[model samples]
Target chain A: MNAAEIYKLSRLAIFWLSVTFGAVWVACWGVGVFIPSLITGKMPFLLQVDNPSTTVVFIADLLRSLTPILSLLVFIPINAMFMVLFERRSLALFTVRMGPNRHGFDGLAQTAADAVKLLFKEDITPRGADAFMFTLAPIIFFAPSIFGALPLLAAVTNNHDLFKVANLPTGIFYILAAASIPVVALVMAGWASNNKYSLVGGLRSAAQAISYEIPLVLSLVTMCLLAGTLDVVEIVEQQKGGILNWNILGGGALSGYDKLAPYWLNLVDTSFDTSAMFGQFYPVPWLSSIMAFVLVICTVLLFGLYLTGACAEINRIPFDLPEAESELVSGYNTEYSGIKFAIFFLAEFTNLFVVSSIATVMFLGGGDNPIPKWILDRLPLEPISNALGSLLSPLIKDLMFIDPATFWAAFWVIVKVYSIVFFAILVRGTLPRFRIDQLMDFGWKRLIPLALILFVVVVFARTWVVCHG
Target chain B: MEFVNVQELVSTGVAEALAFYFIAALAITLSIGVISDKNVIRAGFLLIGVFGGISGLFFLLQAQFIALAQVMIYAVGITLVVVIALMLTNPRLQNEEAEEEAIASSEPALLKFLDSIRNGFPGLVAWIAFVTVYMAIRSEHWEQSTQTIGEDNIAVIGRALTTDYSLPFEFASVLLLAALIGAIMLAKAEKVEDTDTPREGIESGSN
Candidate 1:
């Protein structure tokens, strides 16, 4: 918590994250843009023109189709490495200890080194273990993470043309469905291990996941009910104005009602058209304002529920009972070794990233500046962007390379998603793990009931707030 | 020219057709494995594979929500619960004990065949049901809907659930509630009795 420690951690985090981002950029550009140009002897941008050579069009299309998968493959491993370093560094800051400082620049290369070591280690299958399942389990656990986060990439990047195919109409639902598959993988690993500790661990994971999933689904369902659509892009679009419009604040409940209430009040008033007078006197109409307040409270509670369930789902600290070292000996993955174990490790961090991104899209405004548009308009950002855009116009507009909207969108997404990730790390630092019975009780008896009530309340309260529809 | 037509076919409708066949093949294979797998837990896991393949088909059909529901409810939730329960009960112990008994008794070959057939009765019934459904599908000249799922299918579902199909939806909810309550009561009743016996063992162990 010391200022110096925080500064050092932040600097370290930024440096590593930039490395990951750079690697992803290079890989994506190399495969999706440069290689196609090399092969076809034409720029991808030129292929977009009317009646371009069909061969050029086909090659570009193929490259575009492959970009999402290629970038995702590059992104996951690098992002996981950055997150591992971030968590260790943050934990060190909390505990007043230096963490992973021996390797490249405050232990940035530590995870990479560990990954190499893991790859070189022996992958062993026990004599009594189900060998096929033992091998397949980690693959099952890890594959969904890659696929599940694909749709979010589209939503986060403001539906960038390259990622538009990932944007299913049932976006968040597909992600949730994919996310749920990992617990099955955990159970499979546990049962296939032929070890008692692994069995117990896997069972605990299954129970915890199934129980907590209710609250998580309920909270997201509540957000969907408020937003009135399942499309992640549309949901994010609805929350565009400011902080007040974000789903965390009832998806613009107050701001929208403020606009509509004066007119409705004037319609009822017989004395004169007192709508202007009403606006002048009571700027925040009382009844709908009260409903908006309730909506905000419910939204906040649902967001909290979502965060808790997400933490549990990803098996982060405070909900890592399945892998509670004191009890279950690393739980379901006790017998995993080498690359199998590496995949599990990678998927865990990737799941954390995916969960954070989901929260950003659903609760925080995805790719939206927190600053209101009016204030942003008053500022000199547009002119600066315009100047920058003019300078890069040839590279941007004609070449289809650097769009300011996509740039800002990606910037804000990174900011919001990483902030959520930092908050998760903070929670891990502060809270102790829950006892098994306590965890069950909290998920089933408390969170689920609260989430259900909040969902019902939002269902009713959304009608009073005009923007929700 | 023939090659160009073939390529065009692949570029247009062949991909979807290929995908449908691939997923259908996978589901059929996995379903067979589910029935034929020797280990109960492995069979349970195979059930998930079958569900996943079916979900892929649902995805190909543009039933995205249904595809997701199939994965969530059938592939992950139900199959995981089944597998966990099977593991917890230690079905291997029962199988080992059964094997020992069979060894001791030394059943005749004909009887053994009959016993396996008896055990396979459920599988036979499942096959019959599948064939019946397959035949029905083949016999019907189905008019497949030309309409694709719109962007607001979820909204359509929500409105339908509340308006046109509200009664059935409410009835389904009631049935689920009933099932949940029944399960809880059964569990609680057993727990009370089990706890009473466990208390005596704990007291004696402490002494």
Candidate 2:
């Protein structure tokens, strides 16, 4: 209710974000580029590619492949810790309370402190527990989020050369498949604990995941149908023009209609070139206007369906019945202790980050600037940037501190993904948990049916819009 | 594509074969554990391990898409359901009865011998089946393709499902539909009970 308190919260949030991003950037560059270069310099045959021996080439290729993986390994834990801290701080802000500001620079290092405490705690195994499965559950839970985020790195970074090889042809499908593995881990953790509550929690998790996965997949399939490819990179490319071309606005379907209209109008004129006059004056707008309006409605519905399904899939608040503390005593992870518990904690936050990144890529147009080009071209910043570019060396310019496109693209992505994360945290603070029966009813009876209907409507309407508009 | 060196190919093949054997050994061991383990819930977990090992083998064969599908469908979906069912049944309840039976039968040596034979019957049949399958695999000649597996096997499989194999695809869908409807019928509560159930269930049950 207090506006000044909100402004102070935003300032603290921005400060913490910069510190987290600065650390992430340093870690990525050190592992992905610097360390590899240092190691490669010692292997002479690795550099001499003309007639290198087979083993040397193999080793070189293997090292090259490890670079992206090393960066990812370095990124996950650090980013997860940052996200946890960020969420806690934001939740505090929502309640008008100060949260965890004791450790380092307004509580920035609180997660690190918590990580240390978790490491020192006693790891326990319950009597009559399946010892092997009790140990393996957290690894299974954590490992998929690591590999799943790898494919999205390429799409999120606009296919940067360092991440280019990480892009698989069946990228989004692979991510989905990997993401599905964690439910098994939760069930394993629960059943292996030899506790009744844990067993119930695990059952709830599996049932929730299975029911919600249908709507989530349906929404993504609708977007893929509009984009015409399963490749995440290709899907982003299809939405590269501006905000209107984003998936939330029919995944460029309206723009596709726009392109088809000018040509078809020229054909229909059949006069001594009244087409030129029409192009300038814009006489009729019935079909195009109606189609655009319908497309917008479908897209809003699609985006809403995607957000709901994604929320349920990742076990976010209101949908987090599996781990509802008041009911199930921390649910499936009740018996997990020490570092194993930390891994579950880490993977949960990482899942939040992953889902937000997916939304940023699919609905908000991956790294594209929201501003259209005609307005951007009229801005006076270009002349100043040209002067600044002339003052810098090629290497410094390539380092991208001054490059306009990459800077703004990255700026927008950070803004979009973080905004989604903030929105999730806000929902956590505001919404109360749903009962299990209501949760099932909402997912199956409402969201899934809506998604299917939207998919069908978009399919027929897209063809009509493209061919006749 | 440029040709890979024969010597390099042989070395990589050796490495891949090593990985394949390791995965195969792990899978077989886990499958054995699935049957032999006294605790049914543990055996269910072992089944997941067996599936995971097979998925690893699929990865070694460079079938990435199939490997992922194997994990998603079998390891997560079917095996989790099995484990949950095993837990719900509380298999440990039968241990006391089994222990009492073992104590009672330990006295007569001939009766114990007959009991062992009865218990091992399924193993003997499984060993025989394994031998026959192994001999068949050893004797058959495989027609190895010269071309490498394509990069986009998912697309290839998708196209085939819609084109040449459309009838089979439709049949699979029909079978799934039947299963889904049957499951709904089995799980659905009676109409007379639905109203009472929701009131008790939502308001008082969970919390």
- Candidates in order have lDDT scores of 0.84, 0.78
Task: Tell the DockQ for candidate 1.
Answer: 0.42
lDDT tens string, model 1, B1-207? Answer: 122222353456768899889999999999889878878899999999999999999888667888899999999988878888887685678589788767746888888888788878998998899899999999999998888668767678878999999999999999999999999999899878978898999999999
Model 1 misplaced regions, further than 4 Å: A30-53, A257-285, B1-11, B92-131, B147-149, B191-207
Q: Candidate 2: which stretches are off by over 4 Å? A: A36-63, A257-292, A388-408, A466-469, B1-11, B96-121, B124-132, B186-207
Taking chain B only, the TM-score of every model is 0.76, 0.72
How high is each candidate's TM-score? 0.89, 0.84
The native-contact fractions of the candidates, in order shown, are: 0.55, 0.42
Error of 2 at A256 (Å): 3.4
Could you report the DockQ of all the candidates, in the order they appear?
0.42, 0.31
Return the TM-score for chain B, candidate 1: 0.76
Over B39-66, each residue of candidate 2 has an lDDT whose tens digit, in order, gives 7878888898899999999888778878
lDDT of 2 at A380: 92
RMSD (CA, angstroms), candidate 1: 5.1
